[model samples]
Target: MKFLEKKVKSMEPIFAKGGKLEKLHYVYDGLATFLFTPATTTKRGAHIRDGVDLKRTMFIVVMALVPALLFGMYNTGHWHMVAESGNMDLPYLNDFGAKLLYGLIKVLPMVVVSYAVGLGVEFIFCTIKGHPIHEGFLVSGMLIPLVMPVEVPLWMVAVATIFAVVIGKEVFGGTGMNILNVALTARAFLFFAYPTSMSGDKVWMGGQEADGFSGATFLGDAASLVSDSPTVDGATGLMDKFSAMDSFIGIIPGSIGETSVIACLIGAVILIATGVGSLRVMLSFALGGLGMGYLFNLIGPGLGNEYMQIPAYMHLLVGGFAFGAIFMATDPVTAAQTATGKIWYGVFGGMLAVMIRVLNPAYPEGVMLAILFMNVMAPLIDHYVVQVNINRRLKRLKTA
Candidate 1:
């Protein structure tokens, strides 16, 4: 037995001290590193180290977003079935299998295209730059499909993904360097490039062409009402014109994954529980949107006969507000890092989204633009936060 133990020990591969294996082990350690190492490092002063790498952080964000993806899949199928049968009366189709399969068929292509094109670009960039491939797109790719209307052309999706990856991400030197969220950039590109395809009510309901569709999203109806009011040949009140409850429950027309607020809330809970996202940001964003929406509702109705306002609740459930707040705005890499900074980011993003949604009659959804805007400002917010910390530290030292 002693001889056998000695042989086994001898056969073990010798590893150099603090060498490649050690570094590899550390690199792959995941969340354990964050707990063990200090977040800051100082050469001569207060040096701290942390094991948490960007990969681990990004992974957490992905985990939190899974619930949303799953729910979005189901909702996509549900809307398609509803549109196919011309049954706007029903909340959800009874046929689960068909609904699910249809949704998978419609959404999977976009998801695959986004991952394929985006990741391909990322890999090429990583190879050229001589750096490890960053997995930021793992979340962004999934997000792309979620924010898009179900009926968006597959070719458009592919083109938009390439555009976002090349222009929005790669041009800025790859992940962690881009100023805006890649997924939002793709959606924005599609929205501007193909306004008719992206915005109308018929777009969200798949198989619209076969069904002789005349669908109108909440925001689309609002815009139509505003644009073609009493002066136009035929016009109606936006609220009287559309089903508010349908919009609230996501039975109405809109983007594929963004229509369902219940699903979004469920996803938000999962994200919060996993510690993958900031509750502060989410809450603040919701509050900001609700506050603005209420203010708009109160003020718009009082403005005049033609300029009517949408309900407050409609703003929260309609378009991409919930989806963006729960997923896009909370992106740690492109969002404010500090707790205080998160509040400002969320509020600002929500306010901007609502402002554009209500104020600008041309574009309907503003969540994508709002998120992209905040992403650009995140670094500035973090810088100011860090400066505040520095000032506090200096004051403490002086007192000491």
Candidate 2:
């Protein structure tokens, strides 16, 4: 390890100013710094230093996401196998090693494709603009595949990666400057451009279409029951068959990572403990969803819509609500900057997510749209919060 570090240091001059390879300084610096601690430091400034640089910070987030990634892989494999064999109760599919292998085969290619295309575009931009490569894509690359359906074509994934990198991140001046989550941007692009592949029942669980296999996710089932007079007992009965425990454990069919509330919760704990994620956003987002879910429950039995009667607690368990709240909605760059603004941002996003999920049958899962919508509103939310503080200070000065 020390030998590699020394070798990188020895080549520094070649990539430094007036050196033979100075044209690719950004590339060299990125590689060298990524492997070793950067030699450069502030000579004079009021900077409060921390050991956690951008790379380390992003690395921690990636670590936090590992639980979801692992669980998603197993679930992906289990679903595909079940779909292929047409037997939901197959006990052999329960083996951890077999499930892991199954998931790895299906998911690895998507991950590789995402990183290759995304980083390729990122490298091109950085090399052209003479800017240091940002570590933002490290998280985005992993997230793109995690949030997508397993059956989405590799070509589609590549195209979405390009669109996300170029339009989502780079167009807004790259990385920290973007208004939307780059990963979700790829998903949104895919969702809008290829609705047939992105949504619907058949596209979710990867399998070579077999007899009597249904891929409809819990959210999809709930949406279909909207017109029926669904009672609490009826909703519970229906959900029980789907195995609520599996949803919590993330053994159900859905997006690779969104099915498991438990895995997302584990991620939330890591994010909060590490102080890398906003507790304010997460809490308020969950609260907002619960609030909306309860309101729906109140008005639901009166209405014939079974979707409305779904318990408020179930809202946290199903679809992308938990995953989005923990990861996507808490994105520091795109979320509200102010402490108070984060609260409102989360609250509004949460409410909107549930409202969309229940009211609009066209969109069964509302987390992506909700988070993106709030991303645009985050700046506005922070502005108001800052203005309110300024007004309070002004009033205090006037009274004094």
Candidate 3:
């Protein structure tokens, strides 16, 4: 304790002494407080306190993402190997290490580039604005790569990062002030700017030309079903076209971390267990998506269309649904804070996502759009919820 005191005292002189330098240091410290609030003593009159801070909260989120990260690495290698050998039936245990390494090779660079470019811009903005750096990007940087295709060009990743950081984040006054999740903004940039690289049939599988690769993601199959041409031979069932089991296990091609429903569920459990995320929102989102999928299945025949009969479970496991529900839709800063508000927010996000995926033939994935849409509506959801509380309090006051 003495040693720690001495170290803090040693630094205090720099901040305590008044000058331009001291003012700058004070600003830095103040910014640090804003970015990472410390749990200090309260004045005791009617103060309420909690042990958690922004950094701790963000760290919990990062922990929740680990399962997906591990699964993404394994799946990336798994799909590449399958594409190379034309053997989708191989078990994970047969060549686990090699596949993991291959995926690590592809994914690590993207993570590094995202953090470097995104944080570099953030630091510059902080320095110029004479404010301390916000640490929110620490988590956003990790998220951007996980949602991207492994085959996305490094240069494209950099460009997208700049756009997301500058426009999505900085333009809105950084961090807590941003309207949309910055990571998703970066992805949205990539999706529109380079549609061919971001989407289509062949982009998800990663390997050299010698690998003889052709990728078919679950959403890709779903989108193909939207076409007048049959997704599979007329004799084959929809299940045969894309196995429900494969989607659950994440064997099919899609975004890097989004393929594995099992992995995403594991991550979601961790997030909820840690009290770092809202289970109500996640559950509501899944229920909402399943509801929409089931409704579509029932209505397809009545509408005289075979394409609408896609199963509900398929919506949960396919494309970015699992990934978004586990990560993007649960972003605390951009999502509803109240419990009741979260249910509405998540349900809206999930239902709209399924609607977009099933109704629109142009976009193959809807989770990104769904989450972005909810991020915009979260505040409105919270507003009504808060008003309900206010009205209840007024009613109690009158009764008393």
Candidate 4:
């Protein structure tokens, strides 16, 4: 390791200013920083210091996402095989290896495309600005693929990544300066620009082209039930089709990584345990969803409002609620920075997610929109929080 570090240092001069390969300094620095902890330190300053840098922090997030990512792959392959076999009850591709291989075939290409385009844009910007590349996109790149429909076109993925990196991050001064989560920005672009491809049951399942069981998401089913029947029986029947355990275990159809509550919980544990994520945001966001869902339940299923029948627990487990709360909303860059503000930010986002999902049947998934909306409001929430603290401190000084 010492020799490798020395070798990297030796080559650094070649990539330094005025060197022949100086143009690629960003690339060189990125690789070097990834392999070795930076040696330079503040000699004399009042700056707060920490052992963990941005690279290490981002790496932890990516590590936390692994459980969800792996499970998503298996789920993707499972859906594809389920589609191929045309049997929801019978297990398709009975072997785990086979399921994993199939998922890899479908999911890997999207991951590659996301990273390639996002990083390519970042490199271009860094080279033009003479700035080092920001490590923020490392998590966004993985997230873009996870939240997308399995059957979306590769070109669309590329376009979304370009939009997300350039408009979502770079336009706002990049990384921590961005107002919204970059990955969710890409998804928002897709959801709005290509609504047909991004939403609905047909797109959620991987191998829909090959017949098989084609059905709406749980939210989708509830939406349709409201349109079709207003009776309590219809509401009960709709809920019966979906088991809470299956939703928790993530056997249902949805986005690549969001279907499995168990997987998201595992990722959440990793994020919180490492202190990379916020428990305040996670818990508050969940509470908001539960509060909204329960409120809707009190309304009851009647007059074509079947979404009310879905239990609060179901709302938390299904769709991107858990995933977005744990991963997206907890993003240190885009989320509310003030400790108190984070609570407000999360609660509002969670409640709004359920509200949008229930009230606006046109958009079955609301986590994406809710988080993006809250991202824009995060600054305002923080401002109010800071002002309250300021007033309190001023009053104390007067008393003193």
Single out the weakest 10-residue window by summed lDDT for candidate 4. 40-49
lDDT of 2 at 220: 85
In model 3, which runs have C-alpha deviations exceeding 4 angstroms?
A: 1-49, 208-213, 223-238, 302-307, 392-400
Which residue pairs collide, candidate 3?
none
User: What TM-scores do the predictions have?
Assistant: 0.78, 0.94, 0.85, 0.93
Local distance difference test values of all predictions, in order: 0.71, 0.85, 0.78, 0.85
For model 3, how does the per-residue alpha-carbon lDDT over 242-305 read when each residue is reduced to its tens digit?
6788879877787888888898888888888877767888889999998988887766654534
- Candidate 4 lDDT (Cα, 0 to 1): 0.85
Candidate 4 lDDT by residue in tens digits, 221-328: 876554355443455565666678888898888889898889898888988898889999999999999999888877765645667667777899899999999999
lDDT at position 207, candidate 1: 71
Predicted candidate 2 versus true structure: per-residue lDDT over 1-400, tens digit per residue: 9998888889989988999988788878877877887776423211113656777777888998999999899888777777888787866346778878988998999999999999888878888999888778989999999999999999999999999999998998887889999999999999999999888777777864775667788888875543455565558645764666777777677899888898899999999998898899999999999999999988787667667877888888888999999999988899998889999999999999999888888888899999999999999999999999999999999999
Pairs in steric clash, model 1: 33-51, 34-52, 37-49, 37-50, 38-49, 42-47
| Superior candidate under lDDT, 1 versus 4 | 4
Model 2: number of backbone collisions: 0
- Summed backbone clashes in each candidate are 6, 0, 0, 0
Which scores greater on TM-score, model 2 or model 3?
A: 2
